[model samples]
Target: MKVTQIPFQKIGFFSKTMLDYLEKNPKINPFYNNFPDFEGFQKQIAEKQTSFSKSSRLVLAEALKNQYESFEISEKTKTNISLLKKEHTFTISTGHQLNLFTGPLYFLYKIISAINLAEELSVKFPNQNFVPVYWMATEDHDFDEINYFNFDGKKVTWNRKDGGAVGRFSTDGLDAVFDVFSEHLGNSKNAQYLKKLFADGYLKHHNLADATRFIANELFAKYGLVIVDGDDAKLKELFIPFVRDELEHGTSFKAVSKTIERLANNYKIQVNPREINLFYLGDDYRERIIFENNLYKVNNTEIAFSKDEIFKELHKNPKAFSPNVIMRPLYQEVILPNLCYIGGGGEQAYWLELQDYFNAVNIPFPILLLRNSVQVISEKQARKLAALNISKEELFLNQHELITNKVVENTAIETNFKDKKQFLEQQFLDLKEVAKKTHISFLNAVNAQERKQIKGLEKLEKRLLKAEKKRQTHLVERITILQNELLPNQSLEERQRNFSEYYLEYGITFIDVLKIALKPLELQFTILEI
Candidate 1:
């Protein structure tokens, strides 16, 4: 396996907010606590160590112990869980929705980025331990987003009627999904392993939370990856104070809204804060909690509470309240003694809007790290790309643009009209000088002629390029076929393909290569040639 790194800016997919955050632009610095570098981490460790209480660590460790009591885990994971009680052990966490069979290929990339960062941090700060964490987005209620995964160009989905928290969903209809997925996997050793993995993970587990936990643990437990499910009563109890504040003061709304105003001056706002950023999560429903008419009411339901009554309910049933997108990051930071958060660009964009909110709640904002993104190409594809004189970076260009550039480069025709355009501009400049010597009105006619001539040159350039493309049709065909193979659906492979597609061929070594290749702090797009 060979690995190459390119700047995220070269990838042409990230947002300006994310790219600026990665570059540590001063405008973005105010929205986040620390940059995600070694210097930033050293300061972060000091801040977290001073601010995070020891009692909270004990509660976190005990809650994790109770959560993992029934499952079998690796000794490394067990030790990491135990180590959480120590003040020196901090977590490097990444959260994702409980996507079926780990949704897209970047699922592995996110976790692997966390694991590799933890390993790197362990080496950098030997006295302190860094544990990798996969915080399961179990409380998320969006079932449609997590119900299907694309495998070998086909979507293997678990169709079900689910509401409330998706983690609490029943894994009833997944057997049919497994059967369909199994048909795609032949009877090779790797295929058999995947079949059993699916059967054991979803078939045996009762709820989506347990199944997701089992699968994530099975995949990363050896690397001491600790998976946390935040839907537990014990965990919710820790967040009760924040929930109460949201109910009474609407603290998140006040803080995040103000931050969004400032962020919007230079960046696009990611999520708008509601008057109340908490959701009422019941057995069958999860809806926003809105304040109106001197009462706190759950949207889409008849359940309503007065100020005092809502406080009583919060104290009695803390688990019934859930954090929305605006508050989930604060909740994750509050619960974990974390140093950094690894996620995709969208996740980072929202997290960037929450620094003031974290400050308002007196919770330390953890460093935000953009998770590693990868394009896995086979050796055959790599050779094809080289033979076509296409750099890996060029593959990120729009398909039409890529084809045009390749045709212009390989064709014997004068497709590029750059020299002609420059000469025409000079001639227009000379004509304008003559027009200035003659009359002012003549200059307007000269300017119009210049614009028309430039337009004509551009049109002719396109025509010549289109003609050359037809002449070199075979080259265009090869480039199109190879690029499509590498970047499926004209999108990043990590966004469109599932890990199972590669696992079927390379087995567990696929993940092993990712762990070795992904550098979380480098903050670059990785191209892996296998």
Candidate 2:
């Protein structure tokens, strides 16, 4: 959160098709359409009971304790329990890896978007209610990626020697990671606070689930955002039928593949699909899943859930099954009916691909909305442009073009030179007319003098231009430096590690100001400048 400067420029990451789709649908505000109200929003908007794929996909949920636990309940989860979730409660879901500490500003943005959107939904429909949900990416095996977060140019990494589904990893190893991160903070004011938060959550906690919870709760506790880890066995029980169908008939993979093909035809954009169903709780686990599959396996740890199950069992003894992406979404839908999902561009893209899979499984695919992203510019950066007598928009322009335009704007040229030259030509013409009347004697002399004057003016103009160029050499260097900073190999704003640089100039309320300025999301073509 250290202060720095935010360089402003347009981030044109979307394709022409995306822009066109957005532009053409001017009246259709996706988020508002889907999640305008909390009361019956899930049932009405999401169509949770509806099948996702033509093949009939169902929603699934796994419990808290293990990859697949038969019976276990943590006291903490029990204390935070809700009644067998009766009708229509508002829900906001944001996903994050089980980062030992909250991963990055991106993580903050995800949960923040959920909270903000939930608030917006509540206001729009004052009669209803809303709540926040954080979905933990606990079953994810990609430990290397979520193991670190970037701070400024430095990387803060947690080097846990063991790796599987990170949820299963013990939280004891996070202290070393914290120590390394603390050293990198190097005496910043907020560094100590961040370190304290990490220690209290990760080091003092019992597991990765607690670690994720503590960090997320710290940021979103005020907003009443509750976090859920779907790695529980009882939760996976709900997913049993879907797991059985996927294993027996191989429906998920087949259904998703067809959907992707059809989507590509519709949108003219290709999506990658695996021939084999990506739902791999394993064939072994699938048999033990009690899914009505033909195969028989032991009361194995992965799946042993029948269709007739209780919500309390999933909530209490959740350490039973492993929930993958396909199953996880189902779990969310089953646990709490949700109307829509507000997420980033990449997240939206992935969701589009999942729609077919949802349809096949008989679970409704929630409406997806792309969230707002921004680049913040500081007062000092604005002043730098003002001092240079150039607009920051010009800073965003190509460096060479900016310089050329600056040269033309600032160069001093004598307007009288053109008039003087014309006068000399007129004088020569008059002299020639006189010569013709009297004699051809001084005509040559007049022409010679006129030529000399023209040459002198041309030289004078060049000298003046040269002087202006000399005067502006340092300014040109600054522009070059600006280009180097702004137009590097990667995008400046997209890759920025900290939001403080923007906040330093725009104040802590910048996000609020942006929300007001940007709320009626129909306005397009932003050229944010310093």
Best model number under TM-score:
1
Candidate 2's error at 278, in angstroms?
5.1
lDDT of 1 by residue, 320-371 (tens): 9999999888888888999999998898899988989899999999999999
TM-score of each: 0.97, 0.64
Q: Which ranges of candidate 2 are over 4 A from the true structure?
A: 1-10, 15-21, 24-84, 186-189, 266-271, 275-327, 385-489, 492-530
lDDT of 2 by residue, 1-530 (tens): 11222221233455433443444443223212242234535445335434322221112222322321421234333322231132334455777777545554455556666766766766765654555567887777677877776655566777766545676677766777777777766555455566676787788767776677776666555556667676655555556565556545656557656655655644544345433232323312321233334332223454433333422333444444444554555556655556666555555554556665666666666755444444344455556667777764465565656776777676675423678778878877887787777656577777777789889987886676666667889877876665555444334343435443333344435444443433212223232343
Model 1, TM vs. native: 0.97
Most lDDT-accurate candidate: 1
* Superposed model 1: Cα runs more than 4 Å off: 425-450
lDDT of each: 0.92, 0.54
**What shift in Å separates residue 454 of candidate 1 from its native position after superposition?**
3.5
